[model samples]
Target: MKEELIVKAYEVAKERYAAIGMDTDKAMDALQKVQLSLHCWQADDVTGFESAGELTGGIQATGNYPGKARNIEELRQDVLKAASYIPGNHRLNLHEIYGDFGGQFVDRDQVEPKHFESWMQWAAEHNMKLDFNSTSFSHPKSGSLSLSNPDKSIRDFWIEHTKRCRAIAEEMGKRQGDPCIMNLWIHDGSKDITVNRMKYREILKNSLDEIFATEYKNMKDCVESKVFGIGLESYTVGSSDFYTAYGASHNKIVTLDTGHFHPTESVADKLSSLLLFIPEVMLHVSRPVRWDSDHVTIMNDDTLDLCKEIVRCDALDRVHIGLDYFDASINRIGAYVIGSRATQKCMLQALLEPLDTLRKYEANDQGFERLALLEEAKSLPWNAVWDMFCLKNNVPVGEEFIAEVEKYEAEVTSKRN
Candidate 1:
């Protein structure tokens, strides 16, 4: 009975979209090609298998949700469970600390590709690609500085760690037959004001050049910058300006974490500008309540605008999308499903936009028509089309997934504690 109603809703929606010179089928096809890289840290609150280090690097996941993955196998199981409800094939993003250490403490600099052999096998079995990040936080060596440290010995340690991470990403990419995007984000900055800003920035540039010296075929490099971290408030060594300039000069991808920018700043506004220079852009999608809280993403105005601009700029293919929020206060798997689906819904809404007609209105100088159509677009039956999408993908067609998540929690995660 519900299936008939869904098909009926879609038929009416198909006709409504067709009236605006839009094709629902085409929009769904475009969306189906997009693959979001789901971060692995969400399953375990950023506690990786490599160490028992406290979550640092100016980030915090504030929740004590039970049933968090306690081991590699458990994390993998939770990830698979979350992915089952989400439509389409998506990749998993792995932190350097999540390696299979086999209960042995392996320092970052001493890590190698062999440590992730099981991950490669696991990804191959699941038919998913992997993305990676070089973790520089929560370690004893990570004080106020790492790559940008004035101390050569400490700086060299981090440099070697990042270099080894790139090799590991290359191996994962080769095994998966896709380029692994390795993001380099350091926790190198000062809490109070610093006088030697240029000195630190120069040192960071040099360290990046050395770390990126070895070129690998299967791995791609991206540099992420932050506005400020919890303790590192006054000054950040790798500011957005620094990485933007660095990426353009070095021909590398620049990562834009939504929560990394100030609240007043609009990430959507930066895409067109960055697309003009950078090779490609990687998005670490997260919703920031006030500061860089890394709150789970929802279908809000900011996200809608961001995804809409990506489609409007005709740069969807040029931008790599990934989720980067962890909330331990709620059911971990439920958080994954909500955030991932919210992002997809936003993307779908953007895809369903009558872009051609709006562009024509702009070209013809029909200001009121453009504004009116833009406003009216919100009322379109995009939700119906979204239901159709979920139906076609064989996933739950809306609110239905809520029950599945609750069922999993009651039967599985609730028992973990």
Candidate 2:
């Protein structure tokens, strides 16, 4: 898009929003501040550098998309390419598997900060911080149960691995001078009916108590929960209720993955309640097609509501935003750009809302007026403000990124062996 056209469109949009007592500049400023922690798994289809491995733990990234990143260098290059198109300085979220193993196999229990030394150096060079997750899935010992295992040896293995992961996150945080959000989500559940449900839950609670025994200053620990995994359709040891209570009592951050709940559930609705209790929240923003299918995120109602709730509750700094999808069916870099841009767009829309006017309408008990304004807000010129955001960030404006992504595929990714 031409620079003059973008500025002109933004000026018109600024006027339109001003009439309704909304500031487009403030909305754009807020949008730019949102640093989405892009997931590293998306570039390589969750195939980490830990050797050739198959995805397990009831999660899968289904696609035969060529040009997948084969190693650390390629993955980092792909991430930089994607970030070029996205606005704002962002963070990178990593699973423990994507370490600098250097062709040698390092067992999960033995992972350390040295394995990620090169990553920290690289992130420093490129101006990015990092977040982390403990890899409990896609391991031989990850047979249905991990932290909640009846087998003490297998359970201790994962516990050791998780502790090591926290140490690594702490190192990253110290290096970057920021708190790394270390999220712990175990795929420990039963695929079929189990009579020892109470026993497993008891064991899991004990395991968590052991794992979180130590305290770290540079990293925040968060517990995540899911309804169920693919094969594990019967019972989930760490359900939402479990994590919520655990987080509240322990004063730990809670992570809410968008695809982890039932279809009827609204993740946005949980924020107001969570704000009253938890110190902080981490968002794993993804699109779920019916179940826990990690599809690329878009500017849908779920996403808009999630962002709006953050703004409405005045929890912008308190809530950490992150992307959590790995769609290998399309261009990986393109997937990253699309999901990041879509999320920013939704946030932009939410920020542009004339909340004071709507609240007054509600305070006056004007129900129909509030409803009417909401429906009308949908057609506002938020897209023009979005275009201006891209303009200010010096990124490709509008559909211009489509051609640029294609060019990258033709010149770079498609040539990968």
Clashes of 1: 0
Residue 97 in candidate 1, Cα distance off native in Å: 0.4
Model 1, range 1-417, lDDT digits (tens) per residue?
988999999999999999998899999999999999999999999999987667887888897989999899999999999999898899999999999999999999999999999999999999899999998999988988999998999999999999999999999999898999999999789999899999999999999999999999999999999988888899999999999999999999999999999899999999999999988999999998877558999999989999999999999889999999999999999899899999999999999999999999999999999999999999999999999899999999898988998998888888889
* Candidate 2 residue lDDT tens string, 1-417: 388998998999999999999999988888778899999999999989986878999788889889999989999999999999998899999999999998999999999999999999999999999999999999999989999998999999999999999999999999999999999998888889978887888899899999899999999999999989878989999999999999999999999999899998999999999989999999999999986558999999999999999999989999999899999889999999999999999899999999999999999999999999999999999999998999889999999999999999999999996
TM-score of each: 0.99, 0.99
**Overall lDDT per candidate, in order of appearance:** 0.93, 0.93
The list of candidate 2 runs beyond 4 A from truth reads: none
Error of 2 at 381 (Å): 0.3
